[model samples]
Target chain A: MEIFIALLKGLLPVAYLICLWFYGQLFFSADETKQSRWAKLSVAIAVCMHTALLFSLAAQYHRCPLWTQGEALLFLAWMLAIVHLLSEWSADTRRLGFFTLGPAAFCATVALSFLGKELMLDAQYRSSWFIFHIVASLAAYAAFSLAAVLAALYLTLHRKLKLKTFDLTFRKLPPLDKLDKLSAMWSFLGTLLMLASTVIGVWWVRRDGLHGMSPREIGIFVVLAIFLFTAAARRTLGWRGRRHAIWILAGFAALVLANLAGLHGFHF
Target chain B: MILNAPSQPQVFVLGANHLTASVSLRDRLLLDEKSIQEFAETLLKDGVVKELSILSTCNRSEIYGMAEDPKAARTHIENAWAARRNVSEDEIRTHGYFLSETEAIRHLFRVMGSLDSMVLGEMQILGQVKDSYQLASQNGWTDFYLNHIFQSGFHTGKRIHSETTIHEGAVSISYAAVELARKVLGDLRGRVVGVVGAGEMGELAAQHLHKAGARSFLFFNRSMGPAERMAAAFGGESRLLSELQEHMGQCDIVISATGAPDIVITREHVQGALRHRHGRPLFLVDIAAPRDIDPLVGEIENTFLFTIDDLKNAVSGNLELRRQEAHKAEAIVEEEAARIESWSRALGVVPVLRTLREKYQAITDREIEKWAAGQPPELRTHLESLGRGLLNKFLHAPTTRLKQLGEQGDGSRASYYADLLFALAREEKQHGD
Candidate 1:
């Protein structure tokens, strides 16, 4: 069983490579939007392999595989893959897979490197409150990451329009208004999840009287504040275009910082 | 089965354009709406062609049809067009080029792509082509062959434009005016366009703007008659030029193209219009030679003023870009035309396949019935199965080979199959003899 888990973990990268090959075909084909079967199939297969790997890890740990912060990374990657499939199904856009799945594959690979460490399962992790807090926080991170990618694309299209440079790539991207709306939708959802997670964390702290605020807590508050400010700007300042995209990028930076800084048990 | 001769292509097109004929001659040969219907009926009655459509524009006049005798049909159209325009046969011969079969299909595709227009990448040709097609359709002049050809032409035209950057910029001055309005206000579906002046340029600009999806229109001229005429033409309301300022406040775009020697639209009136506009952007296109609108109106906030010179400069800049894009369009046209030609060539194999199937089925049915006569029910079933299997076995080689020949562009293979079908039936009959 151990060897099988290891082999499956190793196959994730191979699956990503196959997906990349199919993605290149979809991106480069002149007129085959309705014929991207290989890309879809490879993504579905990669997602299945990742799911099996997660289940195997859960079996070994005797818990939901997300007991430690490192395990949360794998859950986040799974959310990324699932979100990408959902976006494709909803938007009918194949171009987004490379952006979404490329980061997902990278995160999964990083999670695999952390497999030799202890699972860190304890009584506190078994509590439903801690589980919801961690899972919701990671899911929000996934949403913000998707928003950041869309914001970056919006800025690229904005730059191209300002420069008056038209090309096939420019033509293939979603319309500017649609991109702005999608990015805003994702940011709004992310902000709601982040607020919910923060509320849960505060309740936990009050109930247990744990360690005081740390750098990771500050990072989370700052990220949450940035997104709330962006939401306010949309109505008050009529914020859109370059300014809106920049706000999402800034929030994404804070999200990355929080993930890196949250370690010493003083963090959410 | 009566199979069509393989070498005589059915579809043909004959036309003279700005490239082939003088503008005066093209103008004389132009067919109006009623004349188009008349000519369609006349050509169908001539018996030389079974299908007909006349695409008459200021730049060109062309006839598209399906003909029994492609060459004779070409001459018949040439003679008819000459008689209608009161020109001589020698004149039509000198000016017109007759296109048959693949050339006709290729030429239609090129025309649809605007590669054959006077100005490269002009979009009006597409609308004119569609109108001609619709006219032909309504008159019942379009048969299956013409229908397929026109539909394919429309699809190929759309594919070329979308896949290539051929139609990147506006090529005409009037359309350039509309494009300028659209650049500031994306999607002009709900926008109001006010045409101030009844000049030819103003009318043309309004027509193009309306086609681009501007819903509301206001026509203003010093004379009420001209204003009403313009209003009736564009499906809009007419307001006297004296009352232009009162109505200008409601318009999103104002086109100034009056024949007045002085400025017809002043800065003060435009600035006042901006006040009522509530910061919404206003586009002013002053396409008069003597300069109709005040250029100072451009300095006002939220107002874009473009004059005749600005439009001219825009046209020149876009013309260079269009020239470059037209190169890509040429390759696209060539590729798609070849694709359409290949389709028509494949059409040639249809009758051959039909004839082969019918002839073999008849031979198998007759032979099986004769052999099964006076036999028991079990023996008859077995004999019928044997005949069916033998027919399939016999046809497997030739039908596959014929389809392969069609794919390989072997025209004579169709004729060869034609002869072989007859010879095989005859040989089977002789064996029975």
Candidate 2:
């Protein structure tokens, strides 16, 4: 059982890397004016690879699959990329695969790096409420990651257009209005998930009353607060264009910093 | 068959276009019936030409001719144009391009197909060139070879345009005007359009406007007759030249294509129309050569005035797209031309192959007759049959090779084999005598 779990963990990163490379080649070499059949096929393969990795991790751990810090982050990144990839694929925006798949590959590599030892099975985390809290937090982080990608693309394209340097890359990007609307859409969904995750975390804290205050919970709460504030500003203050782009980038940066410090930094 | 026949007749084209000459110069050089007759008569009388035809359009004037002596014919045609148009010989000679033989044939095909037009791939030149050919034919000005070449040129031109997307989009000023109007107005249904002049350009613009679903059209011209005729033909109303301003105020779009020397519509006239329409957008299309509308009228709010230059800018982008399409069209033309050439060359080889086959079979028949002469009466027939079978086997390889060569357009082999077969038949006849 241990050997099969180790093999599965190792195969997950390899599969992710293959998916990333295939998607990059498919999108980067595609003709901008016409649909690419090869790109679609590559994306379909990548989706299957991601699904296989997700299933292997879930089956091997025999729990909610977020027991370890690396597993939690990796699961979150995989969920983010898969959700975005499926949505964009259905929308026929195959170009988004390059942005979303790259981060998923990075997270998968990080998860693979922690693959040698079995995760510490915490009896405390076996509770249904705790599992729900972890899942909601990770799912929220995944949604924010997708929003950050669209925000980054919007800023890049807006800068290029302002500089009056039209190029093939710019031409291949979605229109500024479309990118803005897409970013706002993801940000709205991410904000809602973050709020739900925060509520669950608070509820778990109130119900257990055994765990002491820690930097990880504080970091997650601060990140969630920032995302909620930015989403409100985007809607109420009518914050858009370059200003919205900056806020999105700042919120994503904060989340990354919190995740790294709370989860990956202590382990390494 | 004659060996080493002289090469076929050569062709030459000399012409000037809008780029090389002004509209005035082009119009002056344009040959009418009397002029073409006089020119043809002069050439024949002076013994300076073999065969010739003239093609003239708003953009170009060209003379296509065949000559036994190209140098003398070139000099004679240049001098003749100089005298006719009252220009210096050097001036006429410098602007005109002289293409001989294959180049001339290629130029004729290009010109008839509108590849050489100022607006590349415009369809008007094909009809114009066809008209010129018909006129030349009626005048008894062209011989058999010239007629065949012109007819083939027309056919090639039609094939190139139809089989490819070279003439798919708007390339001319009139077409660009219509395209811009459609873009600005979104849709032309229930729109009233006013045509300021009843000239050729105005007629074309009105036709496009009508096709775009403009409900009512009003025509105004310096002369009432042509305007009324155009309006009646299109199921529209005609307004008097004096009511131009009133019509301009009422119509949703105004297409001005006049030959007026000065600006016909001033800024004040447009401002007055804008007020009467209560801020509704008005599209003004000025397709006149010298520009009929005042250039300043474009500045008025709620009114969009597009002169020829503005239309040209829009057309310039589309011209790049047309150029790309033209490359595809050229590929199609090259393929078709090769197919035609191969077919014509194959026709040339068929007769020689037939003659060679007939001579070989005759020799085989004679040999069978001689072999069967001394056999027993009943056995003779069987012996002749055996001889015929042997002859069929002997001829199979050469016959297969000849047929393959004919299919592949190797006329050289056909001539060589024909000569050998003829020699064999002659030698056999001599030995028997």
Candidate 3:
């Protein structure tokens, strides 16, 4: 099991390294559509490889890898890569591969580096309900990461545009309003999914009397609250541009901290 | 001595442009397409220039051709311009820039590549050159040399176009408007562009918008006839100017260039359109001097408004950017010109090289028959091989060196080598005959 985990972890960075090269070409190369299309193709291949690795680990453990530390990290990176692919397709921005894949590579490297340290998970995690809830929560975090990357891009392009220095820089990005709309849409979907997952996990914890609600659970709820507030304010108070972008960032930041600290109480 | 040697019938070009001649002179020299063809026929008939092509745009008029008596051709062109424009021949000569041989070739190359155009890296000149070449070809004026020159010029232009970013950005006001639309709307495919007014600026804006991939175009003008005509040109429909309110909601963009003294589209009309659009972004471009759209309409959310001044600023910025690219394109033009000049110089010696090889083969065949007379079949084959191989090896060095000198564009040295080779061939012919 350790050998399998180690091999998969090793393969993850190799895929990421190839993806990084393609991302550089996509961002720094000419404005030809073919180059970006190939870059997106490489990213898709990497995601597929990561997915195959996750399935192998799942087959080895005889359950979903969600309960373990290294496997959970790997799953988060996998989800992030998929979300990034979604963004690349939806936004049609050739310059985004570097920003999107740079973060995914970091997540994957950290995930792969920390592999084989997963303590054998309990049979309780074998339940499909608990698996679905955790998967939902991780996917939410993935969507949030995609949203945060787009928000940062929006802010950067907005600054460049305001300065009237928009020659070749940020030329491939979607328009400001288009970026904002996408960010908001992703944030809404992420937040809604996170809330649904949180409710499911909380109900499971209570019904099974597994344990008390951890601070990680409360932290996720807080992130969800921020996302909901931002959505409501954008409609009601016309909160837009930097304010909404910042709100999404803060929520994603909270999720990151909670994930890295392993404060969701499944840690060994 | 100069009269004893024949002069080659070489291509020469003489021209005046906005740079050298005033607008009035250029206007008088303007030969439209059909007239330019007729002028070419006249030049051919007059026997001043053997082959002729006329390129006359609004800003420049250049007559390029192969001339048997180039001095007479220059005098004829000057006298013709003087007589036609009622100006002195000396005055016409002073205004024109005359070029022959290498300089003429380079100038035509640069013209085709648009390095010599008023707008740097402009694409219109390529088409114009192609048209000129086509006219000359159809009229049986162009020979192999002129055809080769034009085809090479076109290929060079195409290479420079793809290799440089010369044509990447928008440099004119109409194109700048399209750039702004693309910047704001990502891709304008499937979007509707509403053009209000039948003015030239409005028509140009609509045309640019159509080129930028706006699927549907709505033309609203007080003058119905021109509006429908513009709509027909764009493959779109036209409506009355008063119906802008109804059409505004469907349009992703609005370009207004009406000649009204007062504001035509007020804030109220835009607000109503905004309510119906469901908060999709709408780009409004007002190009009229007296301001067709109200300034207050710009304050509405999801409505981005720009004026004629804004477009001018964009045009200046984009033009400056293309100017930088033009510098890079100039380097490409210089390199291509040098390369073409080398090939042009080499073209003179092709017939001489062919005659030299034929002469060598004749001598070798005669020697082989004499040396292998009454020998066995194997000995005869050996003699033939020995003679042919020696002849090829003996000829190789001189052949390579002369080709090198030919491509170096030393016309006198290449001509001297050709004369020397022909003399040797004539000496060998005496022995064979």
Candidate 4:
């Protein structure tokens, strides 16, 4: 059972790499009419494999896959893949897949390496509320990560346009305005999820009479505040383009740092 | 350079194009769709050409045909074209060029692939070719030879279109604006495009943007009459020059092509529009000769500005890239033309092989009848089937070798050798004839 689980976990990144390669071909190649079907199929295959791996891991451990840091990393990667697929379908922007899948593959690889060393299951593994909180937080992180990726793409394209390069990368990227809008959209969703996760965490803390805030909680609060400010500024002050994209990237960086510190046993 | 023998049907093409004739002469020699159909039918019905298709575009007029007597067919086409257009035969002879056999095959491929077009790598020639071929096919004027050439031509065109960057970028000034807008703004649906000056360039730019999926347009001119006229033409609203800044905020793309001696759109105008735009970028194109928009407006945040020189530079670059890609496309045409020629050559031996097979079957049938004379009815039928099967098996090896020789362009000599070896009697008439 352990061998099978490890094998499935190891295969996760390979699936994502294949999916990425197909999307890369679809974007870089001039003929998209034929490569699109294979790209979509590859995404479906990767998503299905990741879903099966998560469920099998959950069954093997006889608990939700949100308890340990490694398992949570795996879940986060799965959520990112799900979010990418959903966005690709809803947005009609398949070219963004090449950008998003790279990180998903990298995260899965990291989780595989970490799992090989040890599975650091937390003490609050049995708490259902804690599981929900972790799930929401990771989901928010996934959304923020996607938003940052989009922002980076927007900046790259914007610079290329201003400079008038008109190179292959310039041709392959979605329009600057579309990228900006999609980045804002993902940031808005991430902020809402982060708020929900923060609220759940506070409620659980109060009910259980836990101690003061952890560093991870404070970091989430800061990231949440940045996104909220971004959403507010765009609405009230008309903040856009480079400033908006930079704000999203900074917020994502903060979120990543906070998660890393929290995983290292940093407390309030 | 003919791939087939002297006795085989030869492919021929005769035409005059932009390089060979002036616009006046080309226009005078023009054949419309109805006339092209009539012309093809007349030639096919009169036995002047075995198979025929005619392509008549504004830039060129050409006839592609297969005939046993290519010189006669060429002469007939020349006289007929001159008579129809009321032009002298001397005029036709002065402007026209004729190609036969392999030269004709290569010319057709190059035309379909757009390598021979006035604008290298233009895409309309392929569609024109397909239309011509379809007309011929519908009227039963074309057969296996013409069909093979057209199908191969289309394949080559498709390969060049997709595998190379020949048609990747805009080559004209007006279209460059639309291409730039698409790159900056992505899909232009639901986007408002503003046109200024009501000049020809502005109208052309607006037309391109409309085709690129922009629905709403606002035209601003110095006079209200031309603005309204342009607005009515594009289903857009007309605004005065005074309201340019007021309505500029609502526009995602603005094309300025006025004949004003000084800059009509200042930096302050763009700044005012940007304040009301709420973060959405603006694309501004200045196609005026004395430049209507301020060059400094390009420095403003969230505003992309292009002048006539910039558009020209983009177009020239794109054209250069297409020229490079044309070389690659020419290579593809050469390869595909050779392939079709080989396939056509292989068809020459098919008749000889069929006749040989028939002779063998006749001898086998005679022997089977004598052997089964005393057998039962069921047994006789089985014996006849078995003898025919053996005959086919015996001929299969030689048939494969003969096709190989034909495809290698030695078909006529191979057919003669097969006839001598088989001692088969020649038929008085070919199957289709």
Candidate 5:
């Protein structure tokens, strides 16, 4: 059973990588809209395959699982992609699939690399509050991922239009104003979700009698504060266009740095 | 079918115009409602012509008809015009020009296209030609051939206008004068206009000015009655020729259309008017052939004088520009004409080919029926089917080859194949009989 679960987990990253390749081709195609739709379908299939692998691992372990670093990474990546897909579906921002799916494949591959060894599971993680906190935090991160991609495309297209070197691809992207609106809306939702996740983490830590500030917890708070502050600055100054795009990139970069440092140091 | 060749090519065009004839002749030949109805009845009763139409306009009178013979049709038309005018046939025929079929067809095309108008490219002639044809159709004088020819001519005229820039600008002195006035003045709405003569040229210019939105029209002529008539037609007031200088001072634009052998509006007359009026721009159109307005009068401040030569020069210049654009349009017309001609020729060949095929099939059926009568009853059905199949198989290749040839350029070769096929079908029929 362990062997079968490991093999399935190994196949999940390859399936995600295939999806990433299809999406990359789709982005470069002349008929990008048509290719994007095809990419969405491929990603949906990849998500389903990854979910099945997660289920197989859980079933094989015969516990609530979440032991190996590989399993933890795989679960986090899967949750993030699933949350992004749901958000995109609700928001109708299918163009973000091209950018978001690449990172998703990268996370899946990294998770697969850490797939073999068992890790010590935190006792507090079994609590329902812990589950809600982790789920909300990952979901918030997924929305931020989509917001970053939109901001990048918006800035690139805006620059091209300003230079009067507008090509077919730039024309296919949503107008700059629409991109800004989407970015702001997604970040706002992500900040709210992160706040909810933070509150839930505080409740879980208290119930489990954990001591002050783990590196991962501190990283989460710092990243949450960046998003919250950026959102506030955007509202007050009416920050938009290039300025807004730069701040969004900076905020996403801070979150990535915090995640990498915390997750790698904690081996999570 | 009895093939009796046509007796003679009978073609006649009776028309009156400003050129080669005058208004007297045109008015004389103009058919009133009763006369037109009577003329149609008489022509049909006498068998004088098989097809006919009377095209009447303000400037010209024309009778187009096909008769048993050209001379007879010509004589009938001449007598009709003479009878209508109560004049001798000799008097009218001497001035009338008779054209043959080709000349008549080209003339019809040109007339419908407005190339034959007193003012070339005048749009009035197209509507006039259509109305004339409608009248003939109403009188039951238009036949299949005349209907086809006239309709095609009308279409050709439309094609010429749409495809070429030939009619792009005003072609007459009167219209060019109005066009220049409008161009200089922007809009003529509610502007006062003064006319100095009641000659045909001046009357035309005044009429165009009034149509362009002149609110008050004041006419002055040597004869007051004609001036009164002209003013009333345009809803304007008639002033005495003595009051012309006073009216000219008050008017925004002045048009001189007189047959004066000398300059009618001298430099002194215009300079006096310019003093009475606060320095306002005055547009002067002199449409007389012999120059009615003095050329020196243009030296007066705020006065713009346009002579007949100047207007004609503008007309000719615009006509040249239009001619260039018209060349481009002509290319389009030629392409479309060729396309339509090809389609028409292909359509004409289709019925002949169908008949030829039917004739061959009938003969083959007859021959097989004769051969089947000598066979046993059971074998007859089988033999009939076999013969029909064999005959179709034999025809398949040739029929396809003929259709392929028909699809190519100069499909007249298909008609020759049709004739050969018909001959073969006849010979087979004779053998079977």
Candidate 6:
């Protein structure tokens, strides 16, 4: 079982890399639509492999795959892949996979690099509510990451349109308004999930009678506030286009920092 | 049973296109629906062609047919076409080509795939070809040969479109404008389109935008008369050019082609409009000579400004891309034409196969009679069945090989070799004697 788990952990990044390569070929090739079937098959295979690996880790560790930053990152990569597949399915835009899956594969590789050194699961990982908190928080992060990728694409396309550089990349991107709307949708979902996870964290801490909040907890609040403000400004203040995309990207950066600064300090 | 001789009908096309004839000549050669029907009926009645279909468009006039004598048929078609159009035969012969067999099939494939079109990668030719085929089939002017060829042509065209990026982008200026609008604003439905010139260019731009599903139109001209007329035509409101800035915020796409000598829409004007736009991006197309919108307006955030030169550049770039994709389409056409030719060759050996089978059966029957005569009734019947089964088993591999050779474009030689190797004709002659 240990060997099997180790093999799966090793293969997870390879699967994602294959998925990313297929998607990249589909996006950058002249016969763009012809590669959709292969892209879909690779994505399905990689996602399934990632899912099995996560489940195997959970079963072996006797807890959710959220015990450490590395495991959490693997879980986050899985969520990102799932979200990407869902987004591609909903929007019928498979070209976005190149952008979405690149970061997903990178995260998987980085997570794998932390294999032998970070196998020691924390002893403090106990209550079911902690699983919920970590899962929701990571899922929120995945959504924000997707939003940032889309925001970056939006900015690129925005500049391309302004510069009148009607090249292959310009042709491959989705319409600007559609990208904007999709980015906003992901941002809103991330804000809601972040808010829910924060609420769940406070409830868990109170029920357990934890004394004080960590700086990381305070950082999460700040990131959550930034997303909340982004959503509100987009809705009420009519902040859209460049302002909207830049704001989402900034919020995602803050969230990344908050997570990195507190990589090993998430204890209830 | 005696089989009729193979007809050996050849597929052929005689036509003139933009490359071969001037516009006036092509226009003169145009045949209306009724005239095309008359010409098809006459040719069919005269037995000049076995099957016929005529494709007449503004840029090309083509006659696709199958006949026993392509040279005579070509002459007949040219003469008839000239007489119908009241043109001289010399004029028709000078401008048109008479291609037969594989060349004809290749030409038809190219036509259906839009590689032969005046505007490369345009999709209208596919529909025109379909309409012509449908018309010919409905009038009983087409048979299996013509039907298969046209169907293959359609399939090839569809494959070329889906497999290559030939017809992926807009080619014309007005359509390119609408494409830019779509790229920037997503769906054009319910988007307000502001037309600033009310001239031919503006009308053309508006027409393309409407075709792209933009229903709301705002027409502005230096004078209110033309603007109102244009607005009424598109079922939208009209305004004077002087009041353009006041209502510019209402439009999502603004196409300015006014005849003003200097810059009519300044950076400040767009700045004022963007303030009221609430972060919505505005796409402005200045198609006027000397430009209507300020160049500095393009530098503003959330405002995408394009001039006539930009759109022209896009059009040229798309044309170049189409030219590259046309190479892929031509390769597909060549492949499909070769396939059809191979299939046609295979078809030519059908009679030979039937004759060979009949001769082998006769030989088997004679042998069964000669050997089984002395056996008991049951034994003789068993011998008969065994002899026939042996003959069939012996023939299976050779028959498959013969058909394979035929499809590989050696049907005539294969047929000759089958006759000599099996002594089929000699056996038949000896039986007759």
For residue B22, model 2's alpha carbon misses the true position, in angstroms, by 8.8
Tally clashes: model 4. Answer: 0
Q: Model 6, range B1-433, lDDT digits (tens) per residue?
A: 2333388889999989999999999999899899999999988888879999999999999999999999999888888888899677888889878899999999999988989888899888999999999999999999999999999999999988888888878888999999999999999999999999878999999999999999999998888899999898899999888898999998999999888899989999999998888888899999999889999999998899999989999999999999998999999998999899888989877877888888888778888899888788998889888988898899899889988998997887888888788776676677779
lDDT per residue (tens digit) for residues B1-433 in model 4: 1122346788999888988988988898888888987777777778879998888888888899999999999899888888788677787778888999879999998898888889888989999999988988998888988988888889999988886778878889999999899878888989999999988889999989989889999999888999999899989999999999999999999999888899899999999999888888899999998989998998888899888888888888888888988888888888998898888889899778777777787789889989999889999999988997898799989999999999998998898887767665343133224
- Residue A122 accuracy (lDDT) in model 3: 70
lDDT (tens digit, per residue) of candidate 5 on B1-433: 2111234334556655677676676677677666876776776677878777777777666777766576777787678667766666875676666775656665667677766777656668888888878888887888765786688777877776754446655677788777667644546888889988887777788778878888799999888999999988988999888788776888878998777788878888888887666444577877777887888877654566777776777777777765555445445445544544444334434544565566667777788788888788878788778877976887777666555565554445665655675574355455568
Ranking by lDDT: 6, 4, 1, 3, 2, 5
Record all residue pairs in model 4 with backbone atoms less than 3 Å apart, i.e. clashing.
Answer: none
Q: What shift in Å separates residue B268 of candidate 2 from its native position after superposition?
A: 32
- Measured by TM-score, the strongest candidate is 6
Second chain TM-score for model 4: 0.91
Which candidate gets the maximum DockQ versus the true structure? 6
Which stretches in model 4 have alpha-carbon errors above 4 Å? A1-15, A41-45, A64-66, A204-212, A264-268, B1-6, B88-90, B213-215, B356-401, B410-433
Q: Which sections of candidate 3 miss by over 4 Å?
A: A1-92, A95-101, A104-148, A154-166, A170-258, B1-11, B22-24, B32-53, B66-92, B137-140, B172-175, B187-251, B254-273, B286-300, B348-405, B408-433
Candidate 1's fnat?
A: 0.02
Greater lDDT among 1 and 6 belongs to: 6
- Candidate 5 stretches greater than 4 Å from native: A1-268, B1-28, B46-48, B66-94, B168-175, B192-207, B216-354, B357-417, B423-433
DockQ of prediction 5? 0.01
Per-residue lDDT tens digits for candidate 2, residues B298-396, read 766546677777666656656775687576556555654454444444545555555556666677778767876877777777866776787678767
Stretch of 10 with least lDDT, candidate 2 chain B: B1-10
Q: What clash pairs does model 5 have?
A: B14-B62, B14-B63, B15-B61, B15-B62, B16-B60, B16-B61, B163-B329, B165-B326
lDDT of 4 at B194: 94
Flag regions of model 2 displaced more than 4 Å: A1-30, A33-35, A60-65, A90-92, A128-131, A205-209, A264-268, B1-433
Candidate 4 chain A weakest lDDT stretch, 10 residues: A259-268
The clash count for each model shown is 0, 0, 0, 0, 8, 0
DockQ of each: 0.14, 0.02, 0.19, 0.51, 0.01, 0.70
Worst 10 residues of 5 chain A by lDDT: A162-171
True contacts kept of each: 0.02, 0.00, 0.14, 0.61, 0.00, 0.78
**Best lDDT goes to which candidate?**
6
Which residue pairs clash in candidate 2? none
Cα deviation of B265, candidate 1, in Å: 16
User: How much is A74 displaced in model 2, in angstroms?
Assistant: 3.8
Clashing pairs in 3: none
